[model samples]
Target: MTSQAITPSHGLYREALPKGCIVFSSSEGRAIFREALEAGHMRCYFKMAEQFSTQTELTFCGLTTLVMILNALKVDPGKTWKKPWRWYDDNMLYNCVSMPMIKEIGISFDQFVSLVMLNSLIIKSERVDELASIETFRDHVTRLSRQDDHFIALSYSRKSLGQTGDGHFSPVGGYHPDRDLVLVMDTARFKYPPHWVPLTAIWEAMKPVDETTGKSFQTEIRIKRTQYFK
Candidate 1:
């Protein structure tokens, strides 16, 4: 369902949780990394906010994830053009797509793919109508993490991640095979922080149908690039 379809009981369309509430630890920042090491999952790693430029706007999660992935891969967006072009700038992205468009009609899988391709990133994506099983989802995430890549999960925040929103996008930073939990590095840092949630929870969240396409949301995998944007 689209964000517009959601009927908020109290007039607030979305729910927000304070940082550290989800993970509940004094060392909330290091908890995911420490747990990943203990569980023998792929070593937890991701670029921090300082590594990339992003606006503090609420609806730019998809764009934020795109910038995060690009920065993580060492693709200098600012230098990708002959002249200084901050194409990856959040404002540029928001202006390109428009805030009203994003709010009324969420970003489509094809639109997201085109955005990444425009930046010269190699991306492969698929839409799974039914997740099938937790093991299937777990294996997919684990494999990606092992290969030093991350999956951009398009999920219903309320259904899948226990958040209070319709659809959201974030990168899976790490996977804990033993605990059956996955680290969701949410780009909406102003509202929610990165946290480890049950793998099953994410799988369910991804199963919802997109109102725009009448099909399920998509999961995007970024492959190692052999060439960079000039």
Candidate 2:
């Protein structure tokens, strides 16, 4: 009989995990991650991923704005489309963050985001212009939980993250006393589903920062996961 290698526990796995590596224990955690992503928790998801991965700080305005756009669009992420999703340079940090990596891999930012978003097994909507507010989106998504949905399982390698910022927008994937970083992939170029580390999941202590120099910001959010109905 052949013996299977045993996987280590979270503590051992986490300590030995290389920087940027992601690990998940429970199917429930994975499911929630996917659902939160499809529901427009883009920034939140990224923050979570950062706990396990190395990351650079970004402006809050850009992050929050992206979330707002996604909330307004109200689209399904799982559905594939022929046309590329549209996002302005002013709103995204991809150029500043991923350009070096792309050059190393020989690709453009457009191509990178397109590839990542396309390869993502889970995605929300590209256009979310109808939602009245982030709070409204949150409320609306809360209602979506009662309905049936479906989702896919996909995983990828861990990676270091880079981000561009003008300091005018909300921060994404930044350090917070309440949150732990994890790898949350933005499969869509669209700004919805602020997916990242959930502060509440792996709780941390909070510290105060100078108001003028504080590197933190806030936005309203809503998340939904795919559901399977028999």
Candidate 3:
């Protein structure tokens, strides 16, 4: 995978992944995750896949990203949506951050944290700047991606990854240790597909300050929450 520098669309609907990036739908990308799955590096991938979904609105990246992670972790929203079942949904996630506000512009790291915690979900969010170093971000994700109890999501400047738009969020499906690639399961399905990006590239992408949030980008994980029941 050559590091081809190009401007990629944040929601690259029909755009191609950069040279070094591996498209998740492509055979090569699938094969890489398949190998990792067998190696026990993809436990969280299966859980995430079961609840994967596209953002309902153009600017609902954060809302979309959290919904997937919340459902993946199987955290019951503690409220019935259709009756007899309690599940997390995008609309159900705006308690702390209103849907109107999120649609106007995505949420910042702090906003995301409040929503997650308010929902009773445990989280560990670390901004790129606050981390010991980029390596710290890399190591944390590497471990989280391998486990089943928790899942990771990143809030970063889309432009840093050579993508269009502005700040965006998505979950990490798995990690390919040998190649040092992280699977980004972008929730904005209308634009981009799941892809494998170098770990360091993802780290660098998180270093930019979010003009909307007035803070540097960060990565967050939902530590497994209360078990769900019908």
Candidate 4:
């Protein structure tokens, strides 16, 4: 687990966003969510394993995002579960079920809230329509990230984010008001590195229906209690 700073590069943008990327001013990203970017939160890691033994090199974006957010909030599942990430991922796989059904699908927004509730953490979440304007989405994320004890997780489309996937999940460490960009701490470190992306791109990605529930993905805000584990 390590913390690495990322600088904007033309090659990265060209590869990720061939259609052209939005560039924000330096001052725009200054007021980042410091707590979320702390070394502890940024370094938390999880990988999906096969049969709880061998590494499968599979995707567990939603579970990894949840672990990242919980770590950011200082909530240690390790206090309760021996192997926290794997435990949580297995729970999601078994608990999250839709009528149509897909095996080992990502957890939904509601399931995410339920999991946090089970941990006794204070949580508030809302669905962000994919069709909503970029400004509206930006305002929601900015306002939430600015609050003390608040950290955000989003489920969005990788295609919209210049990646090769349908949907993905990650924690939003900060928002750049001036540039309309958000600092996404991508949990799929095996594939994507942390980076700044346009709020609009995220909005478009989040609009699609999650195959598991037939509902649009969501942005969630979780508040940690100071004495939660006491």
lDDT of 4 by residue, 85-172 (tens): 4233333333345423322455567766676676547776656663456565666676755554556677776766567767676776
Pairs of residues clashing in candidate 4? 130-207
Tens digits of lDDT, candidate 3, 1-230:
88987876774336666677788879998899888777767878888999999889888787888888788777778799778878877777777767788788767778788887787677776666553476667677767777877878877777878876768888888898888888898987777788998888887887888876677777554455654311
Q: Where does candidate 1 have its weakest 10-residue lDDT segment? A: 221-230
TM-scores, all models, native as reference: 0.72, 0.23, 0.87, 0.62
Q: Of models 2 and 3, which has the larger TM-score?
A: 3
lDDT of 2 by residue, 1-230 (tens): 99999887654221232323233334644565555455544334332333222122222223333333233233344433335754322224343346454323333212323432432223332212332244443333233322323211111111211122111222232222223333233322232222344432211111112133342222222222322222
Candidate 4 off by > 4 Å:
1-57, 76-103, 130-136, 220-230
The alpha-carbon RMSD values of the candidates against the true structure, listed in the order shown, are: 8.3, 14.2, 7.0, 9.6
Model 1 TM-score, all chains together: 0.72
TM-score of 4: 0.62
Point out where model 1 deviates above 4 Å. Answer: 1-21, 24-32, 38-44, 48-55, 78-87, 94-100, 103-106, 130-134, 149-157, 220-223, 227-230
- Model 1: clashing residue pairs? none
lDDT score, candidate 4: 0.54
- Report the number of the highest-lDDT candidate: 3
Which of candidates 1 and 3 reaches a greater TM-score? Answer: 3
Model 3 scores a C-alpha lDDT of 0.78
Better of 1 and 4 by lDDT: 1
User: What's the ranking of the predictions by lDDT, best on top?
Assistant: 3, 1, 4, 2
- Can you rank all candidates by TM-score, best first? 3, 1, 4, 2
